[model samples]
Target: MSESLGDPASAEMNATAPETFRARFETSRGTFVVESNRAWSPNGVDRFYNLVRGGFFNDVRFFRVIAGFMAQFGINGDPVIQGSWRDANIPDDPVLMGNTRGRVSFATAGPNTRSTQLFINFGDNSRLDEMGFSPIGEVIEGMEVVDALYSGYGEGAPNGNGPSQGRIQAEGNAYLEADFPSLDYIERATLVGEN
Candidate 1:
C-alpha cells in the first residue's frame, strides 16, 4: 500500500496518477453498479484502494433517500458492512471538502460513526459539517440519473429504503421491507487526468 493512502500532501501528487473506481449496490429491488469520477478524488487511487479493501461497500444498497435532500447508502444492516477501518473510525475529514450538491459523504450515526454507509447530497448542506458530516467526493456527472429516481414509500416501493422503517430498521424485522432503484448499475469508473 502507498504511504500516501492516508497522507494529504501525496494526494495531490496522485493527481497525475491514473485512477479508477467501481461501487455496487444491492437492494431488495435489484443490484446496481455506480461508476465514480477519480479526477476530483481527494486521495486519488489511495482512497479507492482503501474503499475496496474495506469490503463494506460491496453489494450494499442505498438505504436512505430524501428527494431533493439526500440519498444515503452503504450499510447493509449486516454486521459485515458496519464499522470503520481497524474498527477504529477515521478522523472527520470535514472542512477538507464542502457538502455541495451531488457530493458523496460518509454517514455517521454520531461523531466518527462513519464506516461503510455514505450519503449523496442533493443540495448544498454546509451546515452538515457543523453537525459532523464529512463529504469525500463529488459527482462529476450522472446527476440526471440520480434525480430521476422514484420517490415512494413502503417495502420495495421504488425510490429507496422505503418510508415505514428505513433499511436499517427493516434489516431484522421480517414484517418490514424497503425499496430502491430499478436496473440501476454503475457502468464503469476510471480515473481521469492520469496518463
Candidate 2:
C-alpha cells in the first residue's frame, strides 16, 4: 500500500474494520447512495471504503457511460493519485452476487486487477458474473440519478467517442473538461455516517 492518495497505513489498519457501510455520492447529475457489504466482496468493499474516506472520487468524471450497458468512474482527479492506483490491484472476490441493475462492482481488466475504478450496472448483466465481476454493493437510493447521467459521448476512446482511460489517468479532469465537457462528475463522496 502506498500513501500517495492518503494515509495508506491508516487505510490498511481499517481494512477489516467494517462489515458493511454506505457511501453517498453527490454528483453533477444528482445524489445516490451505495450500500456495501463486505461479506459480498471483502477486498472490494475495503478498497471502496478507504477510497471514499480518502476523498479519491472527488471531482472524478464518469468518463465511460453507455446507455444500456453501464456507467464507470473512480479515477482520481489528481493524475499522480490516479497513476499510483493504476496498478494497485486487490485480490479477486468470489462472485457472491450477480451484476444486476444498480449493483456496483470494481472494474477490472482481468483477475486481481481491480484498483480504484468501479461501475454501476445499468441493466441485468449476469454474464459478467461468469467473467468474475463481483458486486460489492447496490444503489440503495437515487438509481434514477445514475441512469440519467450524461451518455452523449457514449463509450470511451478506442471503443467510442468518449474520453480515454489512458488519457484520464495521464491528464486527469483537465483533459476530460477540455474535450468531453458534457461528462458528469462526482462533486464529492462521503460515508453516510461520517461528517
lDDT winner: 2
lDDT score, candidate 1, position 41 = 36
Give the residue spans of candidate 2 off by over 4 A. 1-14
The TM-score that candidate 1 achieves is 0.56
Error of 1 at 67 (Å): 0.6
Error of 2 at 172 (Å): 0.5
Q: Report the lDDT tens digits of candidate 2 across residue range 1-195.
A: 225365444545246638888999999989999999999999888888888877888899998899998999988877887776787788999999999999999999998999899999999999999999999899999999999999999977797888888998899889998999999999999999886
Q: Model 1, poorest ten-residue lDDT window?
A: 186-195
Q: Which candidate is the best by TM-score?
A: 2
Q: In model 2, which residue pairs have backbone atoms overlapping below 3 Å?
A: none
lDDT of 2 at 44: 89
Report lDDT (Cα) of residue 32, candidate 2: 100
